[model samples]
Target: MKILTIDTGTTNTRITLWRDGKAVSVAATQVGVRDTAITGSRSKLDEAVRDTIAAALEKGRTTADDVDLVLASGMITSNVGLHEIPHVLAPAGIADLARGMESELLPHIFSKPIWFVPGVRNDVENIGLHNCEEMDMMRGEEVEVMGLIERLSLRGPAMLIMPGSHSKFVCIDENNQITGCVTTLSGELLHIITHNTILADSLDRDFATEINPEMLLAGAELAKRIGLGRACFNVRTLDQFTIYQRNDRANFLLGAVLGADLLTLKNSNAIRMRPGIDVIIAGKPILKQALALLVQNDDYFSGDVTVVPDDLQPQLAGLGAIAVARARKLVTP
Candidate 1:
């Protein structure tokens, strides 16, 4: 099947063209929901989405009619994005996601089925750090989780650590269902602290910024030894003391943020209570960070850690999984 999968995230929007369950072409734009909102309105965001999709398809030497299915996930289904689809509660499987899938006809775009995959919601009380019943909803990650399950041929339970604006620790059951999840604001906080806060002056947020392994290890060690709140000031102090360059400081800050997030999860009821669940890191550069920390903190993470590159684009796998489930009559279309 020819599938077009779109992911509208907070900082970037990506579109991928896949054939027979493999991604053939992919494209991305900075026209994310938050970025678009700063310059224009919802209509403009929709236009950007449409244009990006067209651009991706054009790159693949195909047009809308050539596509058999269009599957969209991520913030695109959020209230702030293109359309709002109610979330499917967690402990949901491929069939559940397929059953909850909503469709729309874009006569201008294609004659194929366009599905908006619903996000997953964890509404169980007191499941997270707060010790109070807090609801956590994830839109795009659910699809990725499904894709990971099928791609890896995983059975029994698995732990997925997806790092992004809001890193997620998700649990997948033997039946390929999202059992539960925890969201950490580590990425957002890292952005705010490094770019918008006082630490910005000491740290460089540039593409050329290189990772300093030594500083990275040091920062992570500090986070583990002294806690994040106390260790955070060291980013500024080291810079102020001329102990590291601006670029090196950026790496250190990143390490600290990731280390803190890892420590929190290590001690959280979600991870500490569940032992021996294999871990898979999904996404890019952040996967490297998580891998380093996970390997170093062996006592906290006893299971294997596998890093899956972003090139696979789990959203596409997830869409195909749901589509297959629907075809097999495992779910109501």
Candidate 2:
């Protein structure tokens, strides 16, 4: 089976062609739903998806008609995407997502109605000021969780940490269902603070490429004891009082925010975490390393922490899409 998977985030879109199980070729573009949100039009998003799919098909040496299945996930199912699909309630598994899948055709992209995988949300029935913080949602990470579980043969109850623009902490039940998720915008917040804040000059307007264990541990520990805001201010003090390089200072800042996120996961009501459960952190090297190091150094969930490398990130969503498609039996060999 030839499967094409499309993942559209807030600022980028990726399309991959998969034959059976392995990825064949991919086409990505810088444009995504952000353009739609900025201009209040979907024209750019539509063109980008169309062109990207064509490029992927061409690069894979296959025509659009030869493809048997096309699946989409991520913000592409949000209101700003090509089409909006409702979210499935949490406690969802591969079968739940497969059953929740919605099929729709956008003649501009493909001849077949692409199967849209529904995102997941916490089961908070009514929104109120008293219990507002207990609600969270995810666009594309659930599918990745399912794929990672099968890919790594993980047993639950496990906590999956996916770091990106919006980092997601997903908790899977013992039955391998996604029970709930906690979302944070620390990645985007770090970007905004680095370029737009007073600490820009002190820490330098850049992110850490390498792991500085001391600075990272220091920031995380400080954040644990004090608040995140005050811990961030310490970055400036580190640059002035200490002889650390700008890169190390940036790592300190990285640690502060991610450390705060770790604290959130531990103390969050959005998802209930059990002690000694398995924790998996997956993302770029910088995030993966920082989180793994924090888990080692700190009094984190007392669970076994698994760190996924950066090399396998490119095909995660594709593996997920293919796996869920087969589960639904939407298209069979």
Global lDDT of each model? 0.71, 0.88
Error of 2 at 249 (Å): 1.2
How many backbone overlaps does candidate 1 show? 1
Q: What is the C-alpha RMSD of each candidate to the true structure, in Å?
A: 3.8, 1.4
> What value of lDDT does candidate 2 attain over all alpha carbons?
0.88
Off by over 4 Å in 2: 331-333
What would the TM-scores of all predictions be?
A: 0.82, 0.96
Pairs in steric clash, model 1: 126-133
Candidate 2 on 1-333: residue-level lDDT in tens?
A: 888999998999999998877799999999988999999999999999999999999999999889888999988999999889889999899899999899998998788889999899999977898877899999889889877887888778899999888999999988899999999998998898788888889866888879999988888888888988898988888888988899889888888898998888888899987768888989988889898898777664688888986666667877787788889996573
lDDT of 1: 0.71
Best-performing candidate as measured by TM-score: 2
lDDT of 1 by residue, 140-169 (tens): 888777777666666757778877778888
